[model samples]
Target: MSNFVEFTFRGQPGYSEPTAREVITSSIPVRTIAIYCFDPRAADAAQAVADYFGDEVYPGDLVLDEADRKIGSTATVFPLIVGGGRAADALRSITVSQHLFGIERVVVVHHSFCGATSFTAEGISAAWKHEHHTDISSLYDWDGISIADFEKSLNYDVSLIRNSPGTPKHIEIYGLFYDIGSGELTEVVRDVPAKVA
Candidate 1:
């Protein structure tokens, strides 16, 4: 438990700012019905989304997995943390009971200048194999183009969810491409009813 435990608030550095501290201490509610914060740098991207919505989200997983831990009170931020999960396994995980956080409208955020989309699919496969020491097959779903491609990935994910027996019925999925340099988030796809979970 000691090792698995992570800091979402109270003990975190963001608590130092008087305004940020006051915002956190005031017991804000996490508006995250469910946030699928993606990116190799998921934490930073997630925070950007959180700031956008003025909601606290719990960190559900580190990288590959969907969901966050959950942060704050009624109007504050709540970020939930999930044990290590795979990135590709996320949408499917939510389909079943595999995700730590249940499925909800997901914020699929992929950043600009991200190594995940920077390299060719084959290039990343090689890097992943070398870095993780596995015979890596292609795992990344490229969302660098228009929102259609981005939504396609989400739709495919939702399809997997719908196929499962006990998936969420009312989940809406959204997609966005975030600019890392400008710290801007652009809507790639508007809200669409997810297949199921």
Candidate 2:
């Protein structure tokens, strides 16, 4: 793939010309995804599991991760192991990536029977503190933030990214929920933070 540039149906060289067997998803990969999961060692580790599906795992580096879809043209997936809760801290931190890296969007995916989504906000905050060795004061609120809340938060986060001095200010954020039981990824709000795995 070419070096990360923009998102769209970027498949042909001529813009009007077409190839005989052009594969999609190469031209347009995912933006960024924040996940709430059972395993703490996400991304790289999870990708080891996901390798059965032919996915290359991008580990540790958030902005450099694909799905992050920044400078690298390859599709990347950044996994923040916010175990068993709404990854508000994870979401907040990802905004920093979007601002830092020129990523065009964000996606938050929560699963149907996820251990993370089953917990309370208090539980999540406590876990975040314990895992990150940080206090609770450094994050924002996602207590009421759900798949339905993506639209509102997307606009808000986009505003935050734009308003932040020196940020690229043209990126879009989205939120989504994936049904693990049904194996279906649902779009909760368009252009909002995704809560998918």
Candidate 3:
């Protein structure tokens, strides 16, 4: 009974959940999910990652149907932008992406001179307490709140993603540091699962 129900796949007549899922899977060939910061300077992070992989397509053209309705995209890399490019915020996205598009790689890129690096966990927590009158010290993990060191933060995020139950064991996870000024990516950590015998 919602007015916008017609826009959903399930709302279409004779289209079941399974059918919709299959249609979506065939539409976009997403193989990698790039998690990066929301900063405008970092907007090209997805394209950079795609270029680094040499097989992915970023900002690909959209596919249109006979009626000129948008059907899908030719892109292979899906960018998940979040604060600090933290794995904590991208956990659910990884799970959902795998479920929908069957992603093979998860890339976490923390850029240089990021706002997340400007404050400490303690400083942000205390500032929030004074400004918003709420104690957010316990709301999020201290290490995940801000980036003290690029290597440590990237390693922590990669480890966090690897240990999450929602993350498939077969998925390859990578932690990278992006120098915004240089537009260069340095691999900090990479966790590729062992091949099953």
> What shift in Å separates residue 111 of candidate 3 from its native position after superposition?
0.2
lDDT of 1 by residue, 1-197 (tens): 36533444445555655555455434343334333444445455566666665545544322221355444334222322221111244544444322333334555565454443334556656777889988656343433222224445545544544444555655554455667677777766555553644
Write down the RMSD of all candidates, one decimal each: 11.5, 12.8, 0.8
Query: Model 3: which ten-residue window has the lowest total lDDT?
Result: 15-24
lDDT of 2 by residue, 60-100 (tens): 33234446645334445555555432444455656555543
Across 8-36, the per-residue lDDT of candidate 3 in tens digits comes to 88889998887787889899999999999
Q: Pick the candidate with the highest TM-score.
A: 3
Cα lDDT of all candidates, in order? 0.46, 0.45, 0.93
TM-score ranking of the models? 3, 1, 2
Candidate 3: misplaced stretches above 4 Å?
none
- The candidate with the higher TM-score, 1 or 2, is 1
Off by over 4 Å in 1: 1-42, 54-87, 92-103, 124-134, 138-167, 194-197
TM-score for each of the candidates: 0.46, 0.42, 0.98
Query: What alpha-carbon RMSD in Å does predicted model 1 have with respect to the real structure?
Result: 11.5
